[model samples]
Target: MQPGIHPAYRPVVFRDKVGGLAFLTRSTATSDRTVEWEDGNTYPVIDVEISSASHPFYTGQSRVLDTAGRVEQFRRRYGDRH
Candidate 1:
């Protein structure tokens, strides 16, 4: 609420490089690159490596860890003590 003490929170476009998706949202991050949004206004663009659109968990492609292998390895190393 104080004047000149807070960084400007403005609309920015976050583009996922791998997913090839873009969305507009407010952020405090600044960038030199700009992109014309659907509203026909240029907004600062921040290229991201991952986003909800391409995330495995959100896309229902969650990975299953091989816990059995890890458990066997742990048992071989430390299970004898317990």
Candidate 2:
């Protein structure tokens, strides 16, 4: 790797809005906001809408779509005249 050619890889805090969870990880992304972590250190904070904590697949809270009902409704509205 060329020196001074790569972005900085530093620790950042990703905060999940829905679950109110924060985690520290290294990323190339940067944020203006800072947060105090559990280790008594301040790091840049990035707010995310969804993460594994509140994700349906990870949390096993899948939502079933009513496709059959929607199809029946569509057929009733524009079905062949019989």
Candidate 3:
């Protein structure tokens, strides 16, 4: 509750680059860029590379790791006893 010691927390817009999704949330983060929100006022625009909209796990686009190939490669390279 100390004045001037805390950063200002207000509504900010986070834009996901890949999915082109945006959402408003309260944050202390600030930016020089501004955009007119749906509520009709300018707010700081924060650009993010990944969000739930575009994330592999959330979007069900998750990739399977090539564990078998990696294990074979590791055995060929270092698992052999000299």
Top lDDT prediction, candidate number: 3
- Cα-based TM-score, every candidate: 0.82, 0.76, 0.78
- In terms of TM-score, how similar is model 3 to the real structure? 0.78
lDDT tens per residue, model 1, 1-82? 9999999999999999988899999999999999999889999999999998889998899999999999999998888673
State which candidate, 2 or 3, has the greater lDDT: 3
Q: Which segments of candidate 1 are over 4 A away from where they belong?
A: 80-82
For model 3, where is the 10-residue window of minimal lDDT? 73-82
Superposed Cα deviation of residue 41, candidate 2 (Å): 0.8
* Clash-forming residue pairs, model 1: none
Q: In candidate 2, what are the lDDT values of residues 1-82, reduced to their tens digit?
A: 9999999999999999998878999999999999999999999999999999989988999989999999999889999666
Looking at model 1, how many pairs of residues clash? Answer: 0
lDDT of 3 by residue, 1-81 (tens): 989999999999999989999999999999999989999999999999999999999999999999999999999889977
Cα displacement (angstroms), candidate 2, residue 20, comes to 1.2
